[model samples]
Target: MGPLTPDNYELVLGLICFFLIFGVLGKVLLPRIERLLAEREDVIVGGAARAEAAQAEAQRVYEEYRAELAAARQEAAQIRQTATEQGAAFLAEVRAEGQQQRDELVAAVKVQLAADRVIAEAELREDVVQLAVELASRIVGEPLGDLPRTRAVADEFFERADQAAGEVQGSGAHA
Candidate 1:
C-alpha cells in the first residue's frame, strides 16, 4: 500500500467523526449566527433612515432661516426708504419757512425805507424854501418874507423835477 493511503477501518472511522462534527455545528451554532446577522442588518438600515431624516430636518430649517433673513432685509430697506422720504419732507418744510421769513424781512425793510424817504423829502423842502426866501430878500433889498407863497413855488419846482426824473428812468428801462 502507498504511504498516503488509509486502510478500510481507518477511513470508516474518519468519515463517522467528520459527520458527527458537521451535524453538531449545524444544529447548535447556525441559527444563532443567522439571528445575529439579521439584527446587524436591521441596525444598519435603521441608522441610514435616521440620518436621512436628520438631513431633511436640517435642510428645512436652513430654508426657513433663509426666508426669515430675506424678510428682515426687505423690512430694513422699507424703513430706510421711509426715513429718506421723511427727511426730504422735513428739509423742504424748513426751506419753505426760511423763504417765508426772508420775504417778510424784505417787505418790512421796504416799508421802513419808504417812511424814511418821506421824512427826508419833507425836511429838504423846508430847507429849500427858507434858502429861497433869504436869497429873494437879498436880491430885492427888501424883507418881503411870505412862507406860504415860497412853499407853493417849491412844490411846483419839485413836481417838474419829479416828472423829468420819471422820464429819464423810463427811457433807461427801455434801453
Candidate 2:
C-alpha cells in the first residue's frame, strides 16, 4: 500500500474490524443500555404511582379526621344544650319553690294579723264596756250591782257599732 492510501488487504482488514466492533456495540451494549433505561422508567412510574396512592391515603385520613371532629363538636353542642336545659329547669324549680315559700309566709302573716286584730278589738270592747258601767254608776250616784245586765247591754252596743261600720263601708264602695 502507498503511504497515504491503503492497499487492498489493509482495506479489507479494516472493513472487517469495523463490522466486528459495530456488531458488538449494536448486539451487546445497545440491549444492556435499553434494559437499564427500561428498568429506570419502571422505577420512575412506580414511584409516581406510590406517590398518588400515598396522597389518596392522606386524603382519606383527612376526611375521616374531619368527620370525627364534626361528630365531636355535635356531641359537645348536645351536651351543652342538655346542660343548659337542665340548668333552666333547675332555676325554674328554685323560683317556684321560692314563690311557694313567699306565698306561705304571706298567708301566715295575714293569719297572724287577723288574730291580732280580733284580740285587740275584744280588749277594746271590754275596756269600753267597763268604762260605760263605771260612768253609769257615777252619774246615777249609785253602784250598778247587776253585772250580767251590764254585760248584755255592752254586747248590744258592740253589735250596733259593727253594723254601723259595715253600712259605712258599703256606702263608700258604692260612691
Candidate 3:
C-alpha cells in the first residue's frame, strides 16, 4: 500500500509546477489581461467624453441658428418699413400728378367754353339781324333783301346798347 504522506520527489514536483504556473500568470497572462482591461476602460471613458463634446457642439450650433433667425426677422421688419415708406411716397406722388392733370383739364375746359361762347354769340347776332330785317320788311310791305346794310345797322345799334348797359352797371356799383 502507498504511504499517506507524499514522497519528497512528488512534493518537489508539485511545488515546481505550482511556481511555474504562478510565474506564467503573474509575468505573462496577468499583465496581458490587465492591459486589455485598461484599454477597455479607456475606450468606454473616451466614448462618453466624445458624446458630451458632440452634445456641446450641437448646443452651440443651435444657439447660433437662433441668433441668425432673429437677425433675419429684424431685417425683414426693416425691409417692410422701407417698402412702406417708398410706397407711401409713390402714392403721394401719384395723387399730386392726378391733381395736376385735373387742374389742367379744368383749365382747358374753361378756355374751350370761352371760345364756344364767343362763337355762339356771333351766330345769335346773325340770326337776330336776319329776323329783324324780315320783320321790318313785312311791316313796310316790302322784301328787305339788303342783308349787308341790315347787318351793319344792327351792329351799330347793339354797340350803343352795350355802352348804355355798361354805364348803368358802373353807376350802380358806385352807388
Candidate 4:
C-alpha cells in the first residue's frame, strides 16, 4: 500500500454482469411467470361469477314452485266447495220428492175412506128397508110381495130421513 487509491475496473465488470443476467431473466422467465399469474386471476373471477348466477337461478325456480303449489291448493278448495253445494242441492230435491209422495198417499187414503163410508151407508139403507117391509107384513097379517109397493115404502123412508136431518140442524142451532 504505497498509494491507497481504488480501482474502477472491477466495479465496472460487476455492474456489467448484473445487467446482463437481469435483462435475460426479464425477457424469458419473468414474462412466463406473469402470464401464468394473469391466467390464474381470470379463472378465479370467472368461477365466482358462475356461482352467483347459479344461486340466482335457484332462487327463481323456488319462487315459481311455491306459486304453483298455492294455485293447486286454491283449485282444490274450489272443487270442494262446488261438491258441497251439489250435495246440498241433491238432498233438497230428494226431500221435496219424498214430501210429494207423502201428500199423494194421504189423498189416496182419504178417497178410499170416503168410498168405504158410501158402501156402508148403502148396506144400512138396504137392511133398514127389509126390516120395515117385514114389520108391515106382520101388521097387515099378509105378505106384501109387489115390487111397486116396496119402492113406495123406500121412498117414504127417504122422506122421513130428510125430515130428521132438518130437525137435527134446528136443534144444533139452538145449542
Provide the overall lDDT of each model, using Cα atoms, as 2-decimal numbers: 0.89, 0.94, 0.93, 0.86
Worst 10 residues of 3 by lDDT: 143-152
RMSD for each model, in Å, please? 5.4, 5.0, 4.5, 7.4
The per-residue C-alpha lDDT of model 4 at residue 164 equals: 100
Sort by TM-score, best first.
3, 2, 1, 4
Per-residue error at 73 for model 3, in Å? 0.6
The lowest-lDDT stretch of 10 consecutive residues in candidate 2 is 141-150
| Candidate 1 residue-wise lDDT, 57-172, digit = tens | 99999999999999999999999999999999999999999999999999999999999999998898788877878889899987646656766787899899999999999999
| Candidate 1 worst ten-residue window by lDDT | 142-151
TM-score (C-alpha, index-matched) for candidate 2 = 0.62
The deviation in Å at residue 134 for candidate 3 is 3.1
Q: Tell me the spans in candidate 2 whose CA falls farther than 4 Å from its real position.
A: 1-51, 135-146
- TM-score each candidate: 0.61, 0.62, 0.71, 0.50
C-alpha positional error of residue 113 in candidate 2 after TM-score superposition, expressed in Å: 1.6
Error of 3 at 29 (Å): 3.8
Judge candidate 1 at residue 22 and give its lDDT: 81
Q: Where does model 1 exceed 4 Å of error?
A: 1-55, 134-147
Q: Per-residue lDDT tens digits of candidate 4, residues 32-120?
A: 99999888887788778888898888899999999999999999999999999999999999999999999999999999999998899
lDDT of 3 by residue, 1-175 (tens): 2788898899899999999999999999999999999999888998889889999999999999999999999999999999999999999999999999999999999999999998998898888888888899999988885756876799898899889999999999999
Where is the poorest 10-residue window by lDDT in model 4?
Answer: 1-10
